[model samples]
Target: MESYGDLLNNNKVIFDDRNYGFWKSRMKSIIGGIDRLAWKTVLEKWEEPTIKDEKAIHCSVGRKQFELIQGCETAKEAWDILQIQYEGTSKVQSSRKDMLASRFENLRMEEHESISDFSSKISTLAQEAVTLGENI
Candidate 1:
């Protein structure tokens, strides 16, 4: 009986790196054991259009890279998947930074005005009230 790794080894050329060979063979084994529907599900999950966390982008990108190294049908498709994931993650990070900056600016403006402006207004109001009461 031939293992899935043997079949993949027969089909593709092995690289010089032992660790790379092990993972490529492992991925091939997993991919080969499954039916087409299961394979499609796995690939779809790896290339899913949505992301919940920044770290998910790394997984998606890594999957694409592994697929490319394992000789996918289309390199461009793998690249496009990686690009989309990276873009989405970057956008989220950028939006978070913008939100933080806006909050900081608001806090700075409030701090600059609240203490000095309130004290000056209170002092002026007290002086005017005292003057009016004295005249009366």
Candidate 2:
């Protein structure tokens, strides 16, 4: 139930291109928490809420990241650019998905590894796969 103002004062939602997956999720949660229409503006066509949503995204990114979407007219356009930059094109995504599947298939706990450590490794791989639009 956080307000838009609360998000403005929070730095945790900022994107710096280091962890695009995490940043994207946080941004979606914050924007959607404020209003579902605002989140829709980033996914659907441009609308009345686009300006505010675009501004929120524009302000939350670092200088380098800002430059990537400075010319974008809508939040959705900016989001698409950022996604492509980090996630790559569909072909690249397919390659990554294949690699992740291979890793998952070959993944095995080491003899000395703790159960928690092994679980974490599996979770990380699963998250990365999910981030790439894979069901794994």
Candidate 3:
């Protein structure tokens, strides 16, 4: 089995702006796996980690992503910044959810589309909705 240090080094979760939901889940898993306190550092505004959770976050992201969280003092602050940047505010999220719901309601398989292709489209839409914190 890989050591914890090995896991930390090998399983860094890099965030690309396009898939914030997937990246957020992966990063949470990685940090939580490292130590509960480290994950708590991201969730709790005031909790500090013995290990620098911010460093882990910094090392996992690229230069552009780094700029988003560089000014953060706490790990939770950094996490929130990225979350807001990618997920937008709650109002924006609600609007996005409405748009996605409309798309899902109107989705129809094209005449030339295969069943598999149509199913894939549905799956993608469903996944995106789930990423946005929708129950669908």
Candidate 4:
């Protein structure tokens, strides 16, 4: 998620006046923590539903996650909080990818789950691998 976010950010795909809605909505759709950002914009001040939804997302997180993301004003802030907390910096993310590569290579289908489920699991891992700069 962090890698993908960085990829998009590096491409200048978000953060523009024209792209604010597009980037945020894209983030909400594609990124995990970013999804906590509200989709609907209300005319009313602060938008009750938005605040409620953000609070719910925050409250559901663990203490560590909460501490990292505490006092976020928007979903983008929360998303950035988690990314920093988990990945620290881009250099750290590279190291993390190196560490995970071997394990990812060893990924296999478990017998207990159905093939579809197992495929889903591997496909998710594969996507993560791709995110981490691996070819497989």
The TM-scores, one per candidate, come to: 0.20, 0.85, 0.81, 0.44
- For all predictions, the C-alpha RMSD in Å is 25.2, 2.2, 2.3, 12.8
Model 3 C-alpha lDDT per residue in residues 25-104, reported as the tens digit of each score: 77887878876676775777565547554566777777899998888888778888887888789999999999999999
Poorly placed runs, candidate 2 (over 4 Å): 49-53
Q: What TM-score does prediction 2 earn?
A: 0.85
lDDT of 1 by residue, 1-136 (tens): 5554444445443322223323333443445453445345434544443632222112223443555434433323443444344323656646645554454344433455778786665554443333222110
User: Relative to the true structure, how large is the alpha-carbon lDDT of every model?
Assistant: 0.40, 0.83, 0.79, 0.53
Q: Which stretches of candidate 4 lie over 4 Å from their true place?
A: 1-27, 30-53, 106-121, 130-135
At residue 4, what lDDT does model 1 achieve?
A: 40
Preferred candidate (lDDT higher): 2 or 3 = 2
Ranking by TM-score: 2, 3, 4, 1
Error of 1 at 132 (Å): 86
**Highest lDDT among the candidates is held by which one?**
2
CA shift of 46, model 1, Å: 6.1
Pairing residues by index, what is the TM-score of model 1?
0.20
Report backbone clashes per prediction.
Answer: 0, 0, 0, 0
